[model samples]
Target: MPKRIPLQRRGRAKPKFRPRTHKSLGKIELPKQENTGIILDLLHDNIKSAPIMKVRFGKDVMLLAATNGSRVGENIMIHKLADLPEGSLVCNVESRPGAGPKLIRSAGGAGRIVGKEGKLTSVLLPSKEIKKIHSECRAIVGRVAGAGMTEKPMLKAGAGFYAMKAKGIIWPRVRATKKNAVDHPFGGGGKTLGKKKTVSRHASPGRKVGSISARRTGKRRGKK
Candidate 1:
């Protein structure tokens, strides 16, 4: 009899696979109105690689991504895209006007404002994608702090395991071909699957292992 695949089990929403979010301070949200805030403290959240800042803006207190050179008692300005000049670096940018920040919140990440056309502002993301955002969208005016956090090697498998556990991600993933035939679709083969792995986007759970709904498969050939 075939056993349930890892993908199927993960889809079942078991507690072991669920992310642990109880330790999170709160969502990194921007205020509706642009306001200057003072960083009261810097703290770490288990699920995040970047340090978080507790800031007070008037009577309202909120958590925000810690920017490079952020320090306690330091005042920071949160501004809209229209207010920032071109070539400025920003993080935690809102995806839409008044929607709050939704991009570039990763540690050491920042998006550069490259150009503007009418009401749309062009932001160059770290992935090299140029996204057009509304000029009214707000963003923090700095790069996320804790650069080079991933540059250091864990040095041990145990260290890697704990790090993944904090984010509730399964570590040391076993290849499908490495599993037994009854356990995985690509199993029973040696190192190679000996078959095309692409499947339809609407394939059944047990048959949805690899390259689902791919536009094309195999190595690309260049024109001579």
Candidate 2:
């Protein structure tokens, strides 16, 4: 095969857009549920705004996205509770007992069991996608915490650099056109990379820059 083409982002290769999470956060007592699971430590991850929630499920331990003020040592029921209060964070909620929660599990992500229809329970995810899960699948109540994280401005390039450094990421990328012609497709002679910015889908690595395989070029004229 042709080296199994790697995915590209905006004509360039980049890493996944997720934060690096910290695993160790010392030790803390977990909340005790009568017969259910309990939420453990609330810690900070590489993603400044999206907090992490540690919980224990039937001897298996895991870290979930912190939401709805899930605090340390709090009783969290993993299945069918008296009532799922508004702004709760739930996961592993499947139609079948062991299907496993498969939706809306992300940083600053959440879902709610809005309505019930016989066996299928309607859950509106963070993306506003409606999914049907089991009534007894179980979820945690309360919105994922760390609200207003995205509202903060980067302010300066240095601030952004240090922030991404915590996650071991390279920040403040340079434009490809700024390099020499031998370096990037848009590179060279004048301040402008090139008058044209389109490339073919089968272009080689060095020449594969700008609009790839675009069907049309230039702005379209309005109807006469």
Candidate 3:
């Protein structure tokens, strides 16, 4: 009998394939109302690379993604994007008016305010995509902290594995060719994939490993 494919095993959501959510400190979100808060503490979460700031607003407390130059005891203002001036750098931006922070939460990431038009504001994202978001949507000022985290090398396989483990990612990825014929579609073909690697966009998960719905394959030939 053939062993269960990696796709099937992962889809089963077993402990080995599940994200280690127990390690997460808490969800980071903007408060419902605009309020000034003082940072009570800076914390590290096992699942997040960015430092989290615990802030207290009056009697209520909330967690936010720490920004560069942020410090405990510092008073931070939570305001709508429309209230902030143009050319300001921001992070943890809400995609909609009441949506809590759906973008720019990655460590060292920030979105620049290009300009505002009517009820929408344009932001230049870290990926260089210009997205128009609702002006009333809120965000934290400044770039996300933990910059240069990637610049530091792991220097060891164990260190890399532990890092990926914290993020609930499977490390030491196995190539399809290294798998048995029953495991992957491109398996048991030595170095060469016996069949065309490109797959249909509607291919099932078990057979969707390679370049899906590729427009064209092979190296481009210049005008000869």
Candidate 4:
């Protein structure tokens, strides 16, 4: 006899929300510094001139917007760090309102504000597409969080395994259980029968639930 495939079982469900929220000291006022970093690249030109500045942080290159009084080869602290770029239009954002900076609504899609020009601002989209935006859109200034902010740790052997296990994100591998004739009394050797045993004779007639059988109930003849 050939070996039968084991049935799959359900596992424990994961929690929908995290218990603790990430907290920061909030926004602080600080003096603007001079631009002394290397020129990265221009984000937006013609439509709404805005540039993307790259500054050296240790060995890492931090990409920031060249906001007011900023230019290429200038070392200026990103006066504002928004959840997204200033003129960016976003939907389904995972941010608290009036908490930090919010994204603006974009005609094509979501983006981030990079630089400002009078009543207009520059925005960077997910596709790396840069464009101009209106200044009326609310924005916030701050340094971008360090790398690894979006990267999750991998579950590995030993301490990493136990840590993930405690978080309910990792668990032991389970083997499938064998099924027998008692579980499924059909030709197939498995728990659930390969085919339905109770074949309805009248199924072809298109009978439906809660429907009156005209033949059995009898219909009025000639409005009698």
Error of 3 at 210 (Å): 3.8
* Per-residue lDDT over 46-66 for candidate 3, one digit per residue giving the tens place of the 0 to 100 score: 888789999998878888889
Return the lDDT, model 2, position 141.
54
In order, the Cα lDDT scores of the candidates are 0.90, 0.59, 0.88, 0.37
Please give the range of 10 consecutive residues that has the lowest summed lDDT in model 2.
Answer: 1-10
Question: TM-score of each candidate?
Answer: 0.89, 0.61, 0.87, 0.25
Model 2 — TM-score against the truth?
A: 0.61
Model 3 residue 20 lDDT?
80
Of 1 and 2, the candidate ahead on TM-score is: 1
**On residues 94-181, what C-alpha lDDT tens digit does candidate 2 reach at each position?**
4454444445444556677677777667788877888776665655555656556677899899999878866646676667667666
lDDT by residue (tens digit), candidate 4, 25-74: 12222213332345454343221112334455344454443343445565
lDDT of 1 by residue, 168-207 (tens): 8999898889988888889986899977899889988899
Q: Residue 9 lDDT in model 3?
A: 81
Tell me which residue pairs clash in candidate 1: none
Q: Is candidate 2 or candidate 3 better by lDDT?
A: 3
lDDT of 3: 0.88
Query: Candidate 1 versus the native: TM-score?
Result: 0.89
Candidate 4: 10-residue stretch with minimal lDDT: 16-25
